[model samples]
Target chain A: MDYFLVSFFLIQYIRTSLQTAVNHPEWEKRLVFARYFSIAWIATFYIAEEPFWTNWVWDIFLVWLIVVIYRNEVFNSLRTTAQTVMPFVAISIIRDFVKGIFPKFYEENDSFFQVAVAFAFVLCFFVWFYARKQMKVLQKEREDRLREEQASRAQKESLEYLVNERTQELTMQKEELQRTIEELKSTQNQLIQSEKMASLGELTAGIAHEIQNPLNFVNNFSEVSAELCTELEEEIEKSELAEEDKDYIKQIIADLNQNQQKITHHGKRADSIVKGMLQHSRLSSGEKEPVEINALADEYMRLAYHGLRAKDKEFNAALVTDFDDTIGKVNVLPQDLGRVFLNLFTNAFYAVAEKKRKLAAEGFSSDYKPEVKISTKKFANKLYIRVTDNGTGMPEHVKAKIFQPFFTTKPTGQGTGLGLSMSYDIITNGHGGVLDVESIPGERTEFRITIPVSEPISQS
Target chain B: MKILVVDDEEDVKSLFEQKFRKEIRSGQFQFSFSFSGEEALTYLAAHPSEVVMILSDINMPGMSGIELLKTIRRDHPSAPPQVMMITAYGDSANHDQAMQLGADDFLTKPVNFVELKEKLLTIL
Candidate 1:
């Protein structure tokens, strides 16, 4: 009975040890050793009992335990099982033989055997609890480490995104800064150009003033001489002189007249040049007069045409006018407006004449007639004058700089280059108007003047 | 007609004399030249009866034509000669100012000798 009780307890211990081993992989080796030792003790107890049925039951239980361990995948190698179980099996079998030789001594050590089994049960319980607690801590640590890794990855991605955005923003700012720098540089150049023009205007004004005195003397003396020559010729014709002497005197008079005409023509040219420089330097004259716009335009048109014809006998262009009769008197500086009209008309004629000369040179018989057209329109509070020429129109680049002082396409002595600039100043600065040019290369160029018809602006 | 021509430019005397040679030769007119306003005033004080007309350039070195006109108007208030102001610039301010200072006529340079002769004929 005692052996049976010990064997049953041992069987229970072995079953619990095997279950613990299966549950805790970290403690599998130690728990499997305990389970095998308990199994060997149970087998020894059953073998000592000598009950055939109990022995068979124990054997079947052992086989079932092995099957359960195998199913749990914790069953160690056979050598390890033999090492843990064979020693205990050998010890218990020896104990049973000793009891068979000395039954009294074996009976007396039965309590010690029970105590060792109880101690073994306590040790297995302690080991199983310790292993379960250790496994819980290790699982918590692993979960925490995985969470930390995920957080660090997200932080790194956010930092990279921020750096990328900052780089893009910096690039945009740099481009904007570069553009602003270029704008400032251009403005500085324009300012310098204007400053240079201002100084040149002053210098030219002084030079023109100095030239005016001498020019006035030449023109006046030439006229006086011409008048004297006429008087002398009349007196000579009335006098009683030899036929040969009279003929000689007539020849001299003819020569004098021709020379006088040449002198007057060149003097007038000088006078016009001096006038241009003066007008460029002079501020707007503080005088406004009632001027007939149509008549003024017409007069200047004729003057420019005749003036060009006088210079170049070959220069001819058809002049066309479409004046608005309703456009009456406008209060302005007549001299300045006359100059503006004359400049536009002269430029128009020059353009047409040049194109005609070019066509003649090229031997083109194409009926490409050169023409200059003048048109004026009157509004309620403004006047518009349009001058158009079908000639060698200016390219875009030349047209852009046409109004700058000292900028001209004509030969140096032919043009003072201040005509359009002075006209621009007169119309815009002096008369509160606008001068605009439109052109297509090789087709035509048109200049439009728009002047306000309000209360006369006080001159500065 | 006897005229006093006042100008800063010495060449103006020959210009005027040459332009009016016919009239001068015919003894229809006598002309005197003064280089400045002071000289003209002195010539006027000396021969006031001979100078029936005074043509003066408005821009002069010491005293301007307008000043001479004012002085003549002040001194010879009742029997003042016909005073004409000539200027190189046709500025309206100078014209108006000379007119206000008792000038009889105003002309811009270079003066039209024929128009001047006609004007002188009318004045004389």
Candidate 2:
């Protein structure tokens, strides 16, 4: 029986020590010492048949637990270390007390204790295995949750990047759309301006055609009448008329000649105006030809004045020109440049006419003379032409948008609203020049045209 | 010399007669008046040998001056009578086309009668 007890205790000690070593690898040497001590005490309890030495087993196991706690440093706080060690110490002391009191009963029920120990060992092994499986499941769930969180964060970042890119793209597209709208507006204005010019040209061309026939007849009849008058005078001289009668015939012939001269002069003036209108209406041939700039400006200025006079018999203004004769011949499309000058002159005349009418209405006859002055200069490889009117000058607002197409301040039918805009285009865009305006309210308005001396490298 | 004045305007006939009244009275020249191109053609056909010169306006009723010129050039290809074209439009295109159609001279109105008389003397 004692050998059986010795063998059983030795096996339990070896198994427990092996479990400790397996649970904590750093406690391997200490657990081995504890195993030998347990075996020696169990052998003493069995061989000496004494209960006192068996009490040493509980005390030695308590010491071994302390050694495990110190060597592993498993508990971070003293209270936790005490809590972990106190349970085993209490159970071991109780077991030692029971053994001390039931020494004789222990010897008789040794198989009962061995059966309880074996059952306890089986229960502990089962509990340890179940706990290990539960811990593995929990660890796997946490890892999966972490992976899911990281993937979602990455997805959120990608979505944010895509949204930012879309916003930038939209902003860029909006800017492009704005630019396109601006370009379209400019193109539309140009088209409207061209259309207006085209129809006006067609209308003027028809009128010119109709008027030329009558003008030709008037000129022809005047020449014929003048010739007949001379012939009649010669006949009177040959017929031996009285001195008084001859003198009367000569006087009548001279008067007739003067009337014919007036008719011829006015007819030529009308013809020139018709020609100017035709020139304005016709399409520019875009052929560069030599032009006398100052002479051309003066001619158009006179024509504009005469044109207004034909319309309003009472309308008159002082016309002045300071021409630079040195600007003899510049290469330009004569019809186009002529149209520009005609438009400027007409505007000046209209402004002066308006001011004159106003002054006449107010009855302020203190010599508020309406005057238009044209001047030209050539310097620094450029030709500068200026047209000034001392009439009702434009305000700041009117001067600001004077070049925009279809923007006009004149009473509806009196202006086509395209004169200055077309003139601006002709000088600036067509000739690669600059058109500038300087005006003061109720004082004066001046339009300046600056053209480069050299021709542009490209036509378009 | 016999000359034919073809014009749509009736006054041109009297004007021409009045202008050359001295020459006509002296028997230096003879003038025939036709109101239209077809009338001029008919006159020419009736007195082909009598008509030495034809002055026609390019813009006219019935047959145009260009057509008349072409017809004269085509039918009388050999030693044809001199034909001069007159137009109110001074555009070069019409002048060129008229000259191309075998007109002897081109003039734009209002015609210079003195220059025309000089040209007529040269031609005769």
Candidate 3:
């Protein structure tokens, strides 16, 4: 009986210790020492012929060791340990009950008790094996759930990264599309403006042709009438008339002569206007010629001044010119360059004239001499032409939009608004030159044109 | 010298006559007038070699001055009359076309009569 008890206790100890070792690997060595010590203790108790009750003491110590090793899981460990020892405890109770009920039967069938104890041990071992299998199933389920969570987190992070990359690409494409749209809008505007200019040019050409013929007649007849008046005076002097009559005829002739002079003056003005219109309507001929630049500049300056004078007879400004004698000739589109010079000179003269008018109106008596100055200089490979005027200069906003088509400061019907813009195009696009402007409001404004002195190789 | 002045305007004849009255009265020169390029061409065909110079306006009815100039150059190649092309449009294109079509001179309108007389005398 004692040996059976010792064997059952030893099996329980080994099973519990292995379970504890699995739960806490850091206690594995301690558990191994405890196992060997219990075995030695059981052997010593057996060899010394100690009482069977002493084995109970060793079982209690093993339970205490399990409690110490699984401190936080003491109740769970105790339950498992109890399950391991339950069958043995139940078999012992059944044996004691049977022995108490029939003392002689129990004394004669001692081997039956031993067989019953062995059967209980086999059943306990099977129960422990089944429980261990269940634990392994629960552990596998936990590991699978943890692995699935990690995989899902990784997938979520990658999805976020992809979303960010796509968003960045979309933003860049949107910006590029916006820029292209702006470019398209500007190009469309330019097309519309050029179309308008083309139609205007055609209309001007027709008007110029229709007007020039009659203008020629007016000019011719006026001069012929003036000559006839002179001849009539000569005839009247030779006539035998009273001195008062001769003087009266002479005075009439003089008045007629004055009228004829006025007619001729205005007619010439109208003729020049027609000429300017023809020049404007006739686009550049795309022919480059070696022209005397100084002579061209001087001619346009006088033309601009006279054009203005014809309108407002009292309007006058001092015209100053500093021509570069060294710049003898330049290969350029003479008509186009001449148009640019005329536009600059006209703008300068108009500015000074405006300032002069304003000063006179305000009765500002200061010696504010409204002046328009033109200067030409020749550098190594470039020719610079500057037109400066001390006049009512523009502010920042006006200067900013000066080169834009149809942006004009002059009153309606007085300005076509295309002069400076067309001049800008002629200087930059037509001649491959630079046109720059600088101004101080209420003080002065200067426009500078820089062009290559030599003919471009492509033209040659 | 007999010069033919071609124009679409009818008043041109009177203007020329009055402007050159001294020359005409003195019998220094004679001026004839044609209202259109076709009429000028017909006059030239009828009075071949009689005209010393032909002053034709470029923009006229029935036929253009350039076309008339081409015809004159083609038909009277040996001793074609001096043809001067007058245009209101003083553009280089017209000038170039007139020059290319054998025009002796090209003038822009509101013609300076003084300059025209000098040119006529030089040509004669």
- The model with the greatest DockQ is 3
> Looking at model 2 chain A, which ten-residue stretch has the lowest summed lDDT?
A75-84
**Model 3, CA-based lDDT:** 0.82
Candidate 1 residue-wise lDDT, B50-103, digit = tens? 789999998888998889999999999878899999988887889999999899
Q: Which stretches of candidate 3 lie over 4 Å from their true place?
A: A1-157, A194-207, A235-253, A280-460, B1-3, B24-30, B42-53, B70-84, B89-106, B118-124
Error of 1 at A446 (Å): 8.6
The reply for model 2, stretches above 4 Å from the true place, is A1-208, A232-289, A305-320, A348-371, A389-401, A438-445, A454-460
Error of 1 at A293 (Å): 4.8
Candidate 3 global Cα RMSD: 11.4
Evaluated with TM-score, which candidate comes out highest? 2
State the displacement of the C-alpha of residue A162, model 2, in Å, after optimal TM-score superposition.
Answer: 31
Tell me model 1's lDDT, rounded to 2 decimals.
0.79
Q: What are the per-residue Cα lDDT tens digits for candidate 3 across A52-146?
A: 45545554564555446346453444466555656665676666667668868988988998788787766666666677787789889999999
lDDT, candidate 3, B10-101, per-residue tens: 98998899888888998877999999888998898899889999998988878988888999999999988899988877778899999998
Give per-residue lDDT, candidate 2, residue A204: 85
Cα lDDT tens digits, model 1, A1-460, are: 3333333444444445457445655545654564566566667765777543444444444444445444555444322332333333334445555556777887899776555545544444455456558767987999899899999999989999999999999999999999999766655555565566678889999898788888999998888888878888999999999989998998899789878878988999999989877875787666888788889899889989999999999777888999987777889888788889999999999988888888888999369788999999977778999999998999989999999876778864567567899899999988999999999887799999999988543333
Candidate 3 true-interface contact recovery: 0.82
List, residue by residue over A1-460, the lDDT tens digit for candidate 2. Answer: 2222332343344345346457655555655665566567666777888656555565665555555445554423223333433444445454555667887887787676656545544444455456548768987999999999999999999999999999999999999999999767756765676677677779889999789778877877777777788888888889878999899989999999889888988988998878776666667877777788888898889888998999999888999989886777887778888888988989998988888788788998468888999999988779999999988889899999889887777854566578888898888878899999999877788999999889423322
